[model samples]
Target: MRVLVQRVRSASVTVDGEVVGEIRPATQGLLALVGVTHEDDATKARRMAEKLWQLRILDDERSASDVSAPILVVSQFTLYANTDKGRRPSWNAAAPGPVAEPLVTEFTDALTALGATVQTGVFGADMQVHLVNDGPVTVLLEL
Candidate 1:
């Protein structure tokens, strides 16, 4: 599992002109782009969720757990793209949809269980996402 976590002032996702999920935080929060690989499982998802909740990248070095911040979770298999051999990128490292979708859901569910307000983009959808990045802070975690 790999996750790209961005601190954001607000974020939202829309599909076919309809808002699917959004997070309008009164304070700084996070936008989590989740990715799953063949080796990833529920345990990795849970661990990633815990790390995202406690990551201290927000203002004043406060964590999302510390400030009750929200998180917008979006599926992004592209995080595993391989561009080493040719001009075209290879997606062989990314897990297939059927294998990945459930793990992504587990990650979100774990975050919610940890008392974090979680928003999500529809899996496998062509989504349009908008976000106001706070401090332009971003972190990538791989497990």
Candidate 2:
């Protein structure tokens, strides 16, 4: 599993011209772009959620758990793109939707279980994500 975490003032995801999910924090929140690989499982997803909740990249080095910051989670298999080939990027590293979708859900549910207010984009749907990054802070975690 891999997560691209960004500190944002606010973030929202739209699907089919409808707002599917959003996190409008007064000052800070997190946008988590989650990806799953063939080897990833529920355990890894839970671990990733725990890491995201405790990640201290917000203002004044505070964590989401510390300030009750909301989180926007989106499924992004593109995170595993293998572009080593010349023309086109290979998608072999990314897990297929059938396998990934459930784990992504697990990750989100785990985050919610941790007492974090969470929002999500429709899995496998065409989504448009918009956000105002805070400090443009971003971190990538692979485990």
Mind giving the per-residue lDDT tens digits that candidate 1 earns over 52-142? 9999998888999999999999999999999999799899999999999999999999999999999999999999999999888989998
Candidate topping lDDT: 2
- Residue by residue across 41-135, what tens digits does model 2's lDDT show? 99999999999999999889999999999999999999999989798989899999999999999999999999999999999999999999999
Angstrom error of the Cα, residue 31, model 1: value is 0.3
Model 1 worst lDDT window (10 residues):
20-29
Candidate 1 shows a clash count of: 0
Q: Show where candidate 2 strays beyond 4 Å.
A: none
